[model samples]
Target: MNVNEITPFIGLELSDASYEDLVRPEVWEQLVQGVQERELVVVRGIELTPQQQIDLAARLGEPVPFLISKYRHPEFEQIMISSNEMKDEKPIGVARVGNFWHQDSSFVADPAPYTMLHGVNVPGTSGHTKFANAADVYDRMPEEWKAKLSDRIGLHTVGKRLRIRQEHVGLSVAEFKALIDIEHPKVEHPVVCKDEYTGREYVYGSREYMDSVLGFDPNENEAFFTMLDGLIHDETHVYTHKWTPNDLVIWKTRTTYHIATEVEPGASRTVHRVSIETRRP
Candidate 1:
């Protein structure tokens, strides 16, 4: 895999990525639009535990303190998703199986730019996460709809939005509700986020979990959430992932939306997740 010999994946525009060891330089010269050093390359082989995952993420960049959950792993609480296993051991905000989708650390002042997940002892057919192509969603937005949302920001509160699951998964009722009052700016970044290296901008956030869009009236919560959510729910613009043991997926966090696919009882799936905070933010 020579750094100069990179080629595009069928559906993906691989112009920005160069394999460090790839030797076929001619294969990649034609498609690459631009190249910004890739921050990560998924490594497969030895099973990765929480700490092991942290170590690998360290190679790409320093861990940006896991910001989503109140609980922290002594060294690092890299985002992780586990099913059937006791939820307390991992940093999943919503454990068990469910249909919830969200961005990492959006509620916090700074969110991560990338995330890495390594699957271990995965179940036969459970716990695969689906990542929607934010870019596709943004392109489909009607120009008027885009203008309406262009400058808005949304308030996201973990405890307020997913209370029951928070409690069931081990968060204390009192602690979970406390977060609802926190409001986050509903930033309308470029609808399509061009990869700094690939020049491909992807839609990274959604309205379904939005608390408010800048000036949206609080009393009209339903109208606001519904109006924008309907746009994202149109279903033609999303990607769902099914996990495989030893499989690793690293993604551009700033421009993607992901959700945990629940595992049925008597079945189990576990994953270790790590996130990198952008130096710019």
Candidate 2:
């Protein structure tokens, strides 16, 4: 197998290997280590069935099912389909997901540490995913910013996103609140978190889910977070991956934030995703 850096700091691309070659114990170990260190790893030139993808995820960590049942693969619950396809006038899978920068499962108490996606169908142009290395961003941040956020906690919730969706579907505010209270209550996590395996510190919140920084003046919270957002999303710290069929992309959740770009009109794209529970170091 040939390994290439997608960028100096953020991503690694492993090519010239098949799925069989990657599942070998030693190779798999190196692949996992590469993702933890580099933040994102893309394995090119290998097509995976839904079962194969789930099996590969299990080798890395426990493959957990997504919260939304509609997106789960019909045959395999662990595979969540992200597609713009339609079946019987309904979306076959969740469409236009992750259009904003965020970490997977951050609003939950036990966030998944790894997320893997296998591109099954991809557009010839204009459907790409962008990732930013939070660890790298944190490392270069101004000292005062680091000191201010070091001991801070962030309030995270699915409320904002859910509220928008509920409005589109005409759900009442009281009903929306009831649903959120049951399924996705607000949670808190450190603004700066350390990787258990590597001891690397990274900025841990995103505007998509993180509502505010605890103890900060409410009036000042927006400005404070906006400043952090600018630093976190600087283009120099980001790598954009153009999707291709058979590319299996994986990234460490605690170390990176990712967003999906717009797909071209009338273009078709489908990807299967799996989020793995925190793995032991």
lDDT (10s digit) by residue, model 1, range 87-141 = 5674333355326666665555556667777776577576666655455556666
Candidate 2 at 199: error in angstroms? 1.8
Would you estimate the TM-scores of all the predictions?
A: 0.65, 0.93
Question: Which prediction has the highest TM-score against the true structure?
Answer: 2
Task: Indicate the TM-score of model 1.
Answer: 0.65
lDDT of 2 by residue, 146-208 (tens): 888878999998776763653446767797677787877899999998887678898888888
Clashing pairs in 2: none
Tell me the whole-model lDDT of each prediction, alpha carbons only: 0.51, 0.86
Worst 10 residues of 1 by lDDT: 2-11
Score candidate 2 by lDDT: 0.86
